[model samples]
Target: MCDGYATHNGELAIGRNLKVAFMPWKGYNFEDAIILSERVVREDLFTSLHIAEHVVSVRETKRGSEELTADIPNISENATKDLDENGMIRVGAHAKTGDILIGKITPKGESDPTPEEKLLRAILEKAGDVKDASLKQNHLTKVL
Candidate 1:
């Protein structure tokens, strides 16, 4: 019966058998505290990978529709280095925490423009009434 059960389960191993000692170390392991060796961390023997996914959606708003574009205003060039021309992170890009994964802009409401803004708008022939709504990474991960 044991052989049949083992054969059905395919002999799955879930845990590693490590050499354990029951001695206290530096007065820290007094009450069931476990002390791990430096090799465990250096080799990453128990490290696990966690994957998190984030989605950015552009929806219509009362002011106007949100847009996804690479031309985000008031952002530094270094922040958008991983982003492609289509405002999306390139595949295989390493995204760090607080890095913009998707560049997005939302239109602002119609309000009185400042004199300097009016002059620049007239000279540039563009409406600079958009606020950045880009999606940012909350943790370090790789774009796949």
Candidate 2:
């Protein structure tokens, strides 16, 4: 029954954890989220909760399986672009899976864009897809 999923409150990024304790949609109150979660739990329909932050996504699955017969699979953001003290945009995947990241966005005017922007640019510059842009280490960390 969970057909269309969108941001709870804050602007959705790329890979945020939906099950995060501090979800973006707090305005609606934890009660709302909890209520929905409770219903789903009792029904045993959507076996898991997920999130798509501007960086990572938290989802549920067996070991190596796609298509959520219970839901959907092969699931997959925005932050901003910015430079660090060393003037480097740290970006990557922070999922619990073994995904890969590949790309590098040329720095812009230098206001220090958010992680989302940096990652987007990197993707464009290298002409890559979201599935491939995995920053294994550094600023971006894959939770898995």
Candidate 3:
């Protein structure tokens, strides 16, 4: 299981699945992370560009409500239907297979991978899509 923690800019931005691990983790002194992240990308800290991954939500919101409401602070509010009760919005889904990629971002980069990584990537490319989760994971492992 992932720890759901990633740091960014040395401060903490905690939230569900929003791993507070990269930089700017809650109240952390980013004084070091910023310098290092900058150097890493500029100096090729890992053989190539470092890629960080995260999920993006695809949510649904109604244009208007038929009959529902929530209190607004110092503002005029009218009837509104609760999104949770009607939202049911889902990210890209594969019909029949029920498989989905939800969201992903792969950095545009290339590296002189070790023979093993090269082999792994080739194998993964030949066998994938969201349907083969393992392959996708393995491919990412290689890239990272």
Give one digit per residue, the lDDT tens place, for model 2 in 1-144.
232345435554334333524444757755543334565567776554443344433332221111111111132322212222332234432423332232222212325455776578668863222222223333434322
Instruction: Provide TM-scores for the models.
Output: 0.60, 0.16, 0.14
User: Sorted on TM-score, highest at the top, how do the candidates line up?
Assistant: 1, 2, 3
lDDT of 3 by residue, 79-141 (tens): 112112322213322122221212121212234355675477678853111111110122222
Prediction 1 global C-alpha lDDT: 0.81
How many steric overlaps are in each model, in order?
A: 0, 35, 22
Per-model CA lDDT versus the true structure: 0.81, 0.34, 0.31
For model 2, what is the alpha-carbon lDDT of residue 75? 25
Error of 3 at 14 (Å): 34
> Against the correct fold, how does model 3 do in TM-score?
0.14
10 residues in a row with least lDDT, candidate 1: 1-10
How should the candidates be ordered by lDDT, best one leading?
Answer: 1, 2, 3
Give a tens-digit lDDT track for model 1, residues 44-123: 99877786677788998765578888889999999998888989999999989999999999979577567887688779
Candidate 2 lDDT score at position 39? 51
Candidate 2 has an lDDT of 0.34
lDDT-wise, the better of 1 and 2 is: 1
